[model samples]
Target: MTVPHRLSRRTFVGGALLGASALTGCSTVSRSTDVAAINKPAELPVYRRWKGAEPDLPTVNPLVPDAYLRYPRTTERAYSRKPGDGSEVKGSVAINTPIPPPPDRNRYWQELNARTNLNLGLTITPHADHTDKFQTQVAGDALGDIWTIPDRTPYLPQLLEAKAQDLTPYLSGRAILKYPFLASIPTDSWRGCVFSGRIFALPVPRGALSALALLVRADLFRERGVDPEFSTVDELMSVARSMSDDRNNRWAFASVPTSILCTMMGISNDWAEHGGKLTYFKETEEWLEVLDISRRMVREKLAHPDGITSYNGKAWFQSGAVSMMQDTYSALAGLYQQAKGDFEIGLPIVPGPDGAPAKPWYLNPNNAITGVSRAAPERIEMLLDFLNWCSAPIGTDEYTFRKYGIEGIHHTVKDGDPRMTAVGNSETGLGDFPIQYLTESPKPLYLPGFPDGTKEMYRNLKAVTPGMKPGPVHGLYSPTSSKKGELLGKFIDDTTNDVLLGRAKVSAWPETVRRWRRRGGDAMRAEYEQALEVKAG
Candidate 1:
């Protein structure tokens, strides 16, 4: 249920402002004129203390998580053997869901290859064209000893010093005390799999509430009486023009909410800092007031002209045409299991304007990382023993058959939790063929039997985590933002979607922030302000 982090396919085709400029080019950077980053800030690794399972709420704040309300009646198997060595591994990832059941007619991939004797294979792919098939398999080095290194990969420390696998001599410092579930991760998610200083990839933790938001539908805003709270931006454009109609085709917005109007104009998630200097949210002014409020949500039609060429705005908000959109609050529990809950999706209240101060945009703890292929380097201890049985934890048994795959043929438990059986939803694709993409265990917010939809998505991400901000070069590393920051973020998302569809103007946003600071956002803010003064010495 909520230990998913399964967000790839550029977390829904790079929306939320192109995934906040690919998390500000994977956590801020420096030393450009041809890449250079790790001159410090790598000495991280040091987590390895196990003994897990005890949840039902008690994680308090490592930035809020541990919530679970069911499932864990009694379990405890952190690894007594079974990591693979019976030969035949192979991998690939990328997912985005819907394509499971293959590993040779998957019976949870043949009971996780006979409980780790091995013979896996995989390949997966499809996260909306997995970065052109992961850059044609990392430019033909043909990766696959375990893959998925996406953090908007481009030059990523010269593709981890040429095709991954440095894993700092088997998980650095105390050599990760011999893989007790990849040393139970959590050393601040191994600083996003460190690069220039070495650990070359493993983490995927991620948090600080980022499964993007805005969602809404709240039973059609309480049956159109409207007023699901608003405070400005002209009262949410007068509640999206009284929930627009477009001659009854319905269109209260299926896009152009541009990450909730850049959190109602507080905008600062991709590099924020003030007195000490650092700017970058497209050289802010609340990003030119969210490009003049996305050209007034497309000249007041209140959006949804296929929301500027759709890529599943939750299928135009589940065919009601559009009551609102801005996704990934973990695809709201499979769109509430394809609306068996008939309505109510939620996440509004992002208003702000009168006294101004809404903000919301903090995510970037670690998501998407799993390397290990530098041409096999002697299969790095069988890919760290299959990533220590895919970092088990979360009430184990190899995380309940690598995440719900065979109990009465792929899930059934019921009151003690489990669920997913309609032939395990036509065979393993819920949250796309799990094993939590390559390696997991350190993300928790449970949703088992939907504890009130996990307390209304963690009380709406803890009422926007006290105006979240997070990103002053998040984990730092900016070889010109891993080489031309996604081609200068698709040239600033095709010139801000051509000035929000008026086909360009708003004085083309300060010359598109002066061509994204003369291309490379002013040498990635002078290489993240000297990697934030060597991370404050």
Candidate 2:
């Protein structure tokens, strides 16, 4: 898993807010974007005014994203015209995947620019360094016209009020019809983008209730005549021992499998609500149990020594150094890309804890949020138009070009599905320009040309969905969390890592939690609960 970047409290939000007091409260971080306003989830916009192609599969529950067996041929344009005013637009976003050529050199970018009649300059920062660069930009007041707010970026309300445009006038509720493509964005995703009870940003929608699973090298398991499924901890340990061969530098797994274990033990994603009261994972015994499991994995040498910090765990897994690993469901396609058919990857439903039923934890629907610079309020409509063009639904000309790129040049329609050619794979992978995460439409779950992988992933998700538990505070916000979350989180993370690696005693966990609560965790919970109460009314 990629380590999330930490937003420095002293520099990112606190400092910015302090320095921004001189600006008018209406547009700055004082009144319009106050803590109370920022923490409240916006009333969801009505899901009307969108007319687009339907999905091929069943999506009875809105939380479950529609799955696709193959890409459908588009019939109509989502928008009849472009939204640009023939001007230059600059955006800053992070990309950790395959790096694309510069905007000037990338053919796909050239085509998109020509189509929109705008010079869309994107400052694609390295993912690992994005937080630092974002902070530097904020400190220096060098923000671009459009920017992505990464999941863990601190003090979003302050940042928005001080720097980002209030999009309510252009996008609040039915006002979103000006960009039907954006209106097509799932309401749950839009709810997440709210600040101070107003729609402040364009969301990058992910599956609302997605979870991570333990993926195994099934080919290796089958070759070794080992059963991939285990009903108990001991059984799993036996399988781990069989898969590991330390003399040859191989290990049973790449990391401590605590995430899956947490789900199996019925742990909530972050908080659990009961009788309108909130409880955190840190306050539960299962959290300690997860720590025990991690420590045991290290003590038993079942995990790679560098598992926690290795930048290439997937490569290690592919090389057979480790046979089992954990990754998000959305990464199913990329895992196959890394394997290149060398091994058949399999996802086993995590067994229930101590023979009890399992409950998987879902990921937040969005990976990041994009905000328009407050400095360019006049250009809000144009910016929305650009995003709407990017968000053109699954079956439209804009979607086709954005998704597949010049059908013949980058991809070709085969059996009614767009397939990337060798040139496309070499020159234009989705990693080059991560528009999907930067500014996007709802993502359909499909892996083109890999029908078997797609089907297998669908089956896994279908099986896992029924047992999933949502994060209690998915769209709900907490001012305390936005301000002190990163700092308090570090305390918990450091303690967890130290205990798991045997550098500290597991008994030290309770005290760490105590410190966290004293510092800000309890306040965050209270704020969220209050927010939830207000929303309930």
Candidate 3:
């Protein structure tokens, strides 16, 4: 989904007025600091070349008018083929629907086609079996004119390189600038779609430092006389111990083995270098400190008893068997609705040992990039036209509401603001649907409903956490390093799991590090270094 970018005063003022007007009595103009003034724009030292080695856009003053914000009407652009033609200009798409089997092929296709002015040929596949199915389709050249590929598939780079077309020419200059919200998308996420100086894929943009926040039961905290805002791991552990109930088999916290612990420990799966020299995350005191803290969490029993196993922390938390846990923003939404009034959910920033706020390690890449297939060159104009339409605010709103729900029906406007109606104990079937892959649509921001405290909570969390920096390994994409890459991932996972489970002592971490080096970590580093040199040259 699209993220909010650093807004110019003019833009913000205009947007505020619009929001205020929409809400009748609500004051849209909230006091906000100039983001640019408070946070320096990150400097991307590495030069990135678009298709045809195009130069970068001129740096715009955050306060000045950006010409790109101006979007043209649909009729202004030339269509590749006239409407109603039987050629490849068909408005519909064939997508692999993410749902369980016993697929309703006819009704599914009919609903999609009837809903929009398009046709749909859906291939229903379970999310669990999606990767293999997607890979098979790609290998068999069975991909439709427009289709979605899963984000977690390891073959993503290959699919982009070999199957997807360079969409840079379609999105550059006027095309890219047409979407005002596009600026909110981080540059690093855009860079993820670039390969060998060509943009081949469109990404689903996410926040730079989006991470799971620890959702604590506020009433429990108040009763225990503990401050809701615990600033250090030690403080969190103390609360966990105090709140825990082993006799009743309730946990103070249910732990899920997420990369979060490793991320906090500064263990990045993606590492980079420049000019044959390893750059960031390879050796940092902060990284080591994070790891040490994680080890303690497990050893001290503050984490769940089944933390090592793949426990469903969300289920546990919702069932009142656990009082604290970490999860993504979406997870928080689900829990908030499920636990409404019974318990007050509060968000806390991940903290460092010194009890200061620290940014959690995150990998918010732009997923679901829209692109044309090379086999269909003539469809480029049509594809661009569709994308242009999708990028507009109206289109984004429609897509988002469809995915989430419509206001006042599935949701409602509360206190002159838009918010979802509680889905608690309902049979709405809203949660059963999977609407994201309905088409190759533009991404929208995952905003919490207005007038709700959730958005405010997110804002406060963001303010406290340290902002993210571009990883040293930002734009290093080379296929040759695939084998070593797999090995490195295994090495890290094994060592980290062992340490957390107490199978391996924390003191043996240095030995594990040495083993990683011995088992191709050094070679992988060298390969990345060489790739960086080539890019610089």
- Ten-residue stretch with the least lDDT total in model 2: 1-10
Candidate lDDT (C-alpha), each: 0.67, 0.70, 0.45
Clashes of 1: 3
In model 3, state the lDDT of residue 520: 66
Using all chains and alpha carbons, the TM-scores for the candidates as numbered come to 0.34, 0.88, 0.69
List ranges where model 3 is wrong by over 4 Å: 1-116, 151-158, 178-184, 256-276, 279-292, 337-343, 353-356, 367-371, 375-378, 388-397, 404-452, 464-466, 478-481, 534-537
Q: Clashing pairs in model 1?
A: 29-478, 30-527, 505-508
Collision pairs in model 3: 1-444, 2-444, 2-445, 202-369, 203-369, 204-366, 204-367, 408-411
Pick the TM-score winner: 2
Model 2: per-residue Cα lDDT over 1-537, one tens digit each:
112322211112333423434334554354422445555556556565344566666664555566767776686876667778888888788887666776666777788888888898877787887877777777777767888876555566656766778788788777888777778777666766776667777777665324567888888899889888887777878888888887788888888777777777777676788877899876898888778877887888888888766546688878878899876766666766566655787777677765644555664667678888865555877787888888877767888887778877788888777877665664455534666656787767767666676666666666666645446676666766766776777778767878877898878788888888899888878877776776665
Q: Candidate 3: minimum summed lDDT over ten consecutive residues — where? A: 1-10
- Candidates 1 and 2: which is better by lDDT? 2
- Give one digit per residue, the lDDT tens place, for model 1 in 46-117: 676566777766554455566677877548666677767788867787776777767666576777788888
Which structure is stronger by TM-score: 2 or 3? 2
List candidate 1 segments past 4 Å from native.
Answer: 1-83, 86-110, 113-115, 118-191, 205-211, 225-232, 237-262, 273-328, 334-340, 344-362, 365-379, 388-404, 411-419, 422-472, 477-528, 532-537
